[model samples]
Target chain A: MENLDEKFNETIKMGLEIVKETEEDRLMTLSVGPQHPGSGHFRFTIKVDGDYIVYCDPDPGYVHRGEEKMCEYRNYIQNIPHLERPVIHDSTNITYSYSLAVEELTNIQVPLRGQYIRALASELNRQVYTLYWLGIYGIFLGHSTMFMWPLGDRELFIDLLEALTGARVTHAFNIPGGVRNDMPEGFKDRCLRQVAYFEKRLVEYEDIFYNNPLFRQRTEGVGILTKEDAIKLGVTGSVLRASGIPFDVRKAEPYDIYNEIDFKVQYMKTGDSFARSMVPFLDMRESCQIIRTLLDKMPQSGEVRAKLQPNPKGPAGESYKRVESGRGALGYYIVSDGTPKPYRVKLSVGSFRNILALPYLLIGSKLADMPSIYWSLNYWPVEADR
Target chain B: MSSNQSNTQNGSEQKEKVSESVQTSLSKKTETITLEFESSIVNHLVTRFTDKVVQVVYVRPGRTKILVPPNEIVQVATFLKDTLKFDHAESVSGTDYPKDNQIEVIYHLSSYSDEKLSSHVLALSTRVDRNDSRMPTLIDVFKSTEYHERETFEMLGVYFEGHPRNERFLLPEDWADIPPLRKEFRIKGR
Candidate 1:
């Protein structure tokens, strides 16, 4: 008993020294920001008093290239490549909303095959985006193995996407009318095989990362958000779902082929870091099911692209469209005055809304819990700033 | 004296019957109220506050738009939050109309508590003066409008009265040009 007590005291001392408290008079202010590895291109000034965050001020816009302002200068088609640059990894979904909004504005009809292919690309991109976020989330928690596995597996999806769209990273596939082109020969069989293989690897991830006791101890019950607070604060996507509110834009407002596709909205009631992590993990599993179904139901052959004039202009009106991107609900609002270029374009992304809860969640929590909470919110800085 | 006692007893019985009838009518009234509001969100807004809501248009199947005057925006937002259960504001966007010399601000409100209302989007819009763009803030009604209100203020220069912080959110500290979304502020060489 004496030896056990001594060992326990040693563990306690090590934990205390890890998160050192400052002097009462000396409150430390930290800029976890533009230069920091944890924070992306964004910067947030946090004032810590004795290892507890007293105040936090998030400073976004380090990567803002004035995408909305630039949209007014380019015609409809030229804007696709430029718009996809903001969130390059999640390029398909970003352009997907723009295409849907533009389609409503211009009154263009997409072929059924085109719509199915668009949904397929969206599901594939969703996996890539989530995997990229998971990789970053892993590294933030000092789990290097978790970081490498997702990135290494990510290459498989990228290779498949490259075959479909002829580009690996930024596939400027979805235009205003439809996708740039159709699927290549034998693409369906290759896609199904790769997706099925990826699904098997997901089980391995469960064994190594999620089921590990260390990972669970660090994440569970940390940075909890109540259901009332979640809805009152206007958070969307997985963060809201984690709080037990099943408000997925895909389930609530079905765009494209989401209504026809059979799948479930993965959610959790814990509203903590663990819940946030699990929601995306389950979502990746569901994406596999969606991709398989989309492949099976897709039309064999049809016109993928609707031919338009050199520059496509719309009627004098406005349209608002939103899609469930990897981060959250991505909405595009476009106003046109019967001109080739849009009069005003507003891109409301999920990262910005999700980040609003940071200061609320950060205050009074231990500084050690910062990375677990921040990254689990699935914030992408470039996308937020854009 | 005996006749007076009989009259008092009869009066008490009549009072109990009237109270019971009132209870039944009250429940019926509430049932109609819920059905009326639930029948169509657009119709509820149109009938509840006819004067404040200028013109209600059904933009699409899931979207219902209501155009309100700038001053009455607060009133409309409050009614939507309290009477109806539209709990959250999704997006707050401002459009610069240089040709008409006005700027339009639109707020997309949806509900989370009410499952039926969750599927729909209520777009509340109001026009403000272009040069002196000022409108009452809806953050008090819906807390989620806080960040969006700041974005609109910085982007289109539409000053939201009574917002806690109207400072630069997405822009640089030394941004000196006119609001970037305005029509007069042209991009370089555009």
Candidate 2:
């Protein structure tokens, strides 16, 4: 009778301990949501112990539009406008890859002058995209001035793109055969002048943003992605370059006169948020030189667009083409079944690959460093979700 | 500059023509194709997976396609990652071949550490049973392939075995329609 009574008391004590553990919570869950300022069209659930984040789960796809599925419905050329919408700010480069893929499937060749012009617009769009990314990165880390300057400076390129392509953001300039049109009359002199002034503006950016002690303290050593971790996780663009890899798709797989144009691949070994931010800055400087060279070396006059059938189709085959966009290597895989519409169109975006590094980089880091680490990966939520 | 050669399947000839024209106009630099050396990496892969690979073709410049049986994909991927040092997967793409009643999953693997391998993109593909579409995941061999496998899971409904998280990523939680990327999943009002 005494033993039975003791067993009952022990069971009650165990129940009480379970209740106590539930009442005294150690980790707090925070849902950085779809509408949050720091998180862009995406949500992530992070478990925090005080200020330190213990766990993180990135919830992407708030903007999934079934782009691959939709590609089947539209003919090849008609899909350009919708495809570019994923990363509309970096529209040219995204369309550049698509055009290259479509060209491969349909066996269309982009002219020498057309290739140079395409590369020029791509470089210009890179500047626009990077500047916009820098602005958002700045605001994410609570620096108002850094945010304002890049946004204002971005207009210089946007104005140039508007003149060259007519549309500011969604240029729809890249087509399967070649670019839609050639460089506008007297575009060279204006582009050069603005590019030179932009070089001076870059110095101002370095002075205010890169060298700022407060910004450095928050980003310099925080969120360090080692060389091995970076390659293993397959982070691309600035994130991979920041981790000390000199694998730029432009130099690695030169397409559309990238090999002909001379420029150094900008990379850094530090692999921190600061390094991630600085590589794009250095790339902007390199892009200015590339633009000048492209202008100087471009053919005097030639055909820009190759004439194609109303509905271009080719033999059954598959082709994949990649371009070095503002964010790493953006690739398009096209499968043609001798039809006007594609059998399949798979867009392998850099934003999607780069965003995979989040959970690895975010865990065990301070909650305050979340925005700094997240934005440093150069992940565009809309592109990634697509 | 406009030539009938432009519409040929392998546009390398046109690319060369364009390169030559650029050189002639500039009269400053020599235009040379740097991909000659990178093709050897594909040669090495062929030698390694001779019996395993059902077909191997240089689909285009800097792009190689290797087709293998679904059962042998993991083995071939291990050889590429460990021996050939194709460090990371660039992309995982799926093509639904309804006529054949199979789903082709292609893993585009490349390297950042090895300069030669870095320049080459190897498209390793295998066709799995459409009705019972399942294949072993390569996440263990290449960490970068985790999310891509998850994407293939929801998009084409290819079940990647051994993947930790195979839940819906881009689709809604309550979505029960057939995977949208399949050949027959037609968009409404098209």
Candidate 3:
């Protein structure tokens, strides 16, 4: 018995020494890859020390097709179709900024009715994008029901956009100087009814998803990005507003007819994963109100497009214009040297800016909180790469 | 018939004169307001760094441009961030002027804290020789510029001094060609 006790003590001492050695080199590197369902065509390498992430290196550009370089090869109008490809679901808003910049460069004044229609399409597209984001955020947190609900409701807006622009997604409806066509007959009443119904559905979302104890427990305070840190990191869109800064391009810059419309920029002061997710939901509600106002105030009858020469060229100048997309402030800087094709076109997307905050937020966070923290940044991978 | 034509011509002439006068006054009014805002910011910048500021132009009502020497970019950026409260860089874009043998890098700076300046975008630009394009980094001053500076380095081949990670970010790791945004780097069959 004495011999056995001595042997057991020796084994225990050896085991502790092995554990200490492993702890000294315990960081395990993980590649959340381009193939990851949660990562969405983007990859990041994270080194984990036990359960907490010790270091994070985000690797974007897997889907980069040189959109900026491609812009140089195409004419102004031809650029619209491909430019919107980066954020297809929010195509109108993406192209809206480009259109505004092009209009400024060429000195084309869009008629009042055209401006109203453009704003309407933009607001509708914002709803489509936020819903898609909300659905993905839902599934990322293992809420399968949420994934189905928002995506299913998104089809309603898609249908409206199809009616307005003739395509379901990638509606190349917005062009420089004006939209492609006027609103079809009886479209206003149809949009109003569908939007009103969509508002009711939002309450159900709050009950099932937002207020759910499980969702709240996983998301609330999981990744807290302080206001100071948020600004320093250059995050935008819902992420910035979530951090308690009420800066919206529509409110601040007011492109097109947005200045005339009355709507509140919904924001939260929590600056956590939950607040980031919730701000988009609140923005959708505000969007519904804006849509109603737009339809009510639209002119009775007017031209929707300005006549333009084929392969139109602008004088030598540069114009930068920004509009509030679902992700954030999307701006296009166009430099023209009195040519049909732009000399240089630079697209500054919100996702690229917001992704900068990932390393800042991911470090010192538990590995389990990765999805909640990452997706809550409202990052669309394709747009970021572009 | 001659009297009618002359009468119509006289009427058109008077209309043109009235419209021209109205247009001039309207433009003058806008110019005064623009000058007031432009002079305040431009004058302040010129006085602070008289020789560093190469040129100043009001791009539009809300957009302003300041061209500074490449060596003095960091100082101007620091002053803009600390004193002028241009807290963030919205975008950093580079244009290759191959004809001039220079590359122009523009930083579109804006503010969030100052409500009055929220709509304004101050473009702080600098030009460097295309052969050896190098400029100081603004990462220390505006933490938001980390990714933007890296992108400019990779895209335009403008080496940002003191940028910690000046590597291929958006491009493939094995990319051996010239920076893709350069005017000389053409797409296939273009």
What docking tier does model 1 reach? Answer: acceptable
lDDT of 2 by residue, A1-48 (tens): 999999999999999988775522888999997999888999999999
Native-referenced Cα lDDT, model 3: 0.89
The lDDT values for all models are 0.86, 0.86, 0.89
Residue-wise lDDT of candidate 3 within A1-386, one digit each (tens)? 99999999999998998777665398999999899888998999999998999899999999988999999999999999999889998999999999999988888888889999999999999999999999999999999999999999999999999999999999999999899999898999999999999999999999999999999999999889888888777789999999999999999988888889999999999999999999999999999999999999999899898888898887888888999999999989899999999999999999999999998899999999999999999999999899
Tens-digit per-residue lDDT, B1-190, candidate 3: 4633545544444433322322111256665575455445654565465533546644456777879998888888888888788889999989999999999999999988888778888899999999999999888988888898889899999999998999889899999999999999999898
Better of 2 and 3 by lDDT: 3
lDDT of 1 by residue, B30-137 (tens): 444443333356545554554334465433456667789998889888989987889988889999988899999999888889887876778899999998899999
DockQ of 1: 0.30
lDDT of 1 at B8: 58
Please list all clashing residue pairs in model 1, or write none if there are none: none
Over A122-201, each residue of candidate 1 has an lDDT whose tens digit, in order, gives: 99999999999999999999899899999999999999899999999899999877788899999999999999899999
